[model samples]
Target: MKKLTTLFLGTLLFMNNLFAQDQGKRFYKLPIYGKYFETSQQFHRVDTLKYNTMPASVKKLYTNSAGLFVTFKSNSSELYAKWCVTDKKVGLNLTAIANKGLDVYIKNRAGRWQYAGSKGTVKTCEDGLILEHLDSTEKEFLVYLPLYDETTSLEIGVEEGASFVELPNPFKRNIVVYGSSIVHGASASRPGMAYPALLSRRTGFNFLNFGVSGNARMEKEVVHMLGDINPDVFILDCVPNSSPEQVSERTVYLVSYLREKHPNTPIIMIPSVIRELSYFHQNWNNRNHLQNANWKTEYNKLIAKGGKALYYLDTSSLLGEDHEATTDGTHPSDLGFMRMVEQIEPFVLDVMKKHNIH
Candidate 1:
């Protein structure tokens, strides 16, 4: 009788612990939609509701109550979806849409966001796909389309009919990057190939890419946006377009503004990658040297002012010791991007580790 009672108690305890673990895990439940883009105009059409546009490989389609309208083409093999939510309360939604159905993946701050819970299948309703989470602890979310060969078009949105109860965001470290075209990922083969994408994969944290194609000046408005994000690390790599004086002046104010909100977050200043400048014919050497000098001067000043975590990365040795990894003359090729990743990886890892991200 005593032995039986002890066995029963052990079983009950095990069941109780299992239930507790289940309750602790986060669950996402939301509906999602997919669309295609045929032209720049069509792509802009989906920009309504502050939605961000996907790459051009997908066809053009939009939604307006009646449901989503998608066009089918024989040669098409890509699909994209766009949506925006200023409300940080709700987590991301992942979904799929198609008669033939396609295989896909979703990754979040944990890295490599891939679809969960279901496989490719025809949908009976317009918004038949769903993915959702309420936890704000997650920094970044990603949806990967793995069925790139035969599959096209995917629907992604926050899970529908799910309640969102605000919880504390557990992520402590944030990364903010300021740069020009390459940082914005102008012409990578795919979205995942972008350097930000690569770095996000390795570090598993949230990052804000303030990269503007041909427009990342030391502008006050841009700095305001960066300040709003309130990152843990600020990286300025805008040497592709600014003069040395502009870099020094604008960066000083930007760093100061960020320091107001997050006094401890590190600022990582980078110089331009090595490239040929047919316009100047001096190559990227002169511009790089001048920018480095300016950055060092400002960095030292900030340090002298008792800045605790100001940091710098010498990108001259990043792509290669002799400058061998560019595509056109200014932008990074795939190989160049990989090399850039190698250079910044150490700095990022150290910062994240200090904050206990991994």
Candidate 2:
């Protein structure tokens, strides 16, 4: 009787294995977008060789793949993702999906990018279904990486014999945004919810994110690196991470260095978004007022000194009046990020037009 039972269990296990193997899929590497250096294959925003020179905090956050995505065209009836993330931890205020997950977007027939599906298990590596049971029509797909984790490896899986093609970047030029944690995609539910990513989809521009969390203080080394990129447009939103004194001292130097690098590029400065927690905390309130004031003073000085092609972004309505836009009163929730893109997109488009940034 025992031998009969063991033989029956063995046969069942073998059948299950055969069934899983029959569902095998083929994977293809997708081209990454939004990385600062094209030569980097590690999904890092900046060149890894220079990591030792950057601030320790920046060195860590630059690998988070905050604004990176992969694009491809496929006609498979179903889709899956095989990915490995550097971290498998989630923050108290951040979603596990946002930390180490995948979000997929598909371009509809009307030429609009829409969310399709997402997968998040907070594992070091995972192979899971993203979407299935489609009509097998060829379409462009965009998959956003984790918002707060480093993507060491990523590949899209499709049924065997399905047509798949990696797509090239479709944007015109790079619009580099340098800022703090808000730019680093903190508290966003997914990677694509970051304001820079939102701005990219809305305006059809390649907005590269250089959001160095806790280290966008405009230090000499960091500013030098920014100057080296010489993007078509530069947006500085680092006031939230810098003290009033630092702003007063660093603003001029940072802008001046970049101006000297790319004399014709448009340089815009934005003050920090209003933190809702500041309403009741006197210290927080005072800090906001001072930093913004210092920023305005620096902008005036730059303009007075014949800083042409310089612009200022009005951030009064960046978070709206409801005071419910933030997850922790510091970083924006997805709602807040959407509100910011709505306000910022038009102003940025107008600025680019004036500067002939096509």
Candidate 3:
């Protein structure tokens, strides 16, 4: 009994020491994304919201740190981040699922992006955070920003005596995507697992995710702002937010606006993913079909109008007929997200190949 008690005390002390070490070590930190963070960090967002004298509405949307990446080379064995989110309350996804989370990816010697580790906070990043700890060898790393939540403050921290420098943007062309909540990362397990994030990784290309939850209606304000982008391919996946009437009304204008602005840029249109409610409820089927029909009509019209760089993707098989791809019947689960990438990446790569944007 005495020996056991001693051993217990020793184990407890060791555990405490580990926590103390984690708490005591200070990190050499860097902020590497966002417009507000540009002078201090490498900024990735230049959407419609960045212009001078921009409207208050646009400012509210562009303020978040979504779709930003922190590129760096570090030799630290420990990785940490200090972040405070604007929204701490958990929504459809859990707090850890949506808000206080960080994912770290490292490039292997074979030039493949591999998942190194992930961190979750029960509290908020206002209290700071400690993410993955790696070997003390120098390596290239990219940290993806949170998808659903807005960040107020962010800093990447590494161990002392580690060599660190900002990584230059590697790709020449941008993978521009626009859509609704799913594009904004509804139920993704982490910020890094969002469909756009996955697509960027698989292709090793740059991307800008313009998915705003419930607000990506085919508004002229949004589309007109989008016209300024000169992307390799502009992906449209916002039909789920629009009604059939809106689809018929706005689809032509949206395509024409983009085509007028980027005459040679390939535009890819993605209709709504298959909904589980359609298989169970007739109303859902009718509503979804109507919207798709309207969108199809507009796409065909654009083709007839001599859309030289247009590409329309029929996503009927995106989530598959089995209908097990979503967290609810609406948003996709991680499994569904993987399935989505597998299907979508091939088509995107094909478009990229055709345009020589690879």
Please provide TM-scores, in order, for all candidate models, with all chains considered together: 0.55, 0.92, 0.84
TM-score winner: 2
Candidate 1 per-residue lDDT over residues 1-358, each given as its tens digit: 9999999999999999856533423333222222222223321213323333322221111121101112111111222233221111210111122112222333344444433322333332222332333343322233322111122233443322322332222223456667776665533333344566567556655444445555566666556545655555788777667777787887778778878867777777777765544335665567766766787788788888887667777555556654556656566666777888888878777765676655
Off by over 4 Å in 2: 1-22, 39-41
lDDT of 3 at 336: 77
Q: Which has the higher TM-score value, candidate number 1 or candidate number 3?
A: 3
True lDDT of residue 223, candidate 2: 90
Reference-based lDDT, residue 196, model 2? 87
Candidate 3, superposed: residue stretches over 4 Å from native: 1-61, 126-133
Tens digit of per-residue lDDT, candidate 3, span 1-358: 9999999999999999867755644554454542222322233243433453444444355554556667788887777776666544666544474445677788898887787766666555544444444777789888776665566566777766667888776444677788877777777877778888788777777666777766666788778767876677899998987899999989988889998888888898888876766778898889988878888888999889788888888767677767888887878877777888898889888988998886
lDDT of 2 by residue, 1-358 (tens): 9999999999999998856854768888877888767645568888756646877778778888888999999999899988898754688778878788888888998897888888886788888889999887898998988888888999899998999999987566999999998888877888778888888887889998889766799988889888989688898999998999999999999999999989999998988887888889999899988999999999999999999999999667688889999999888999888888787788888899998887
Q: Which TM-score value belongs to model 1?
A: 0.55
Model 1 error, position 74 (Å): 24
Instruction: Please tell me which predicted candidate would have the highest lDDT against the true structure.
Output: 2
* Shift of residue 260 alpha carbon in model 3, Å: 0.8
Report the poorest 10 consecutive residues by lDDT, candidate 3. 34-43
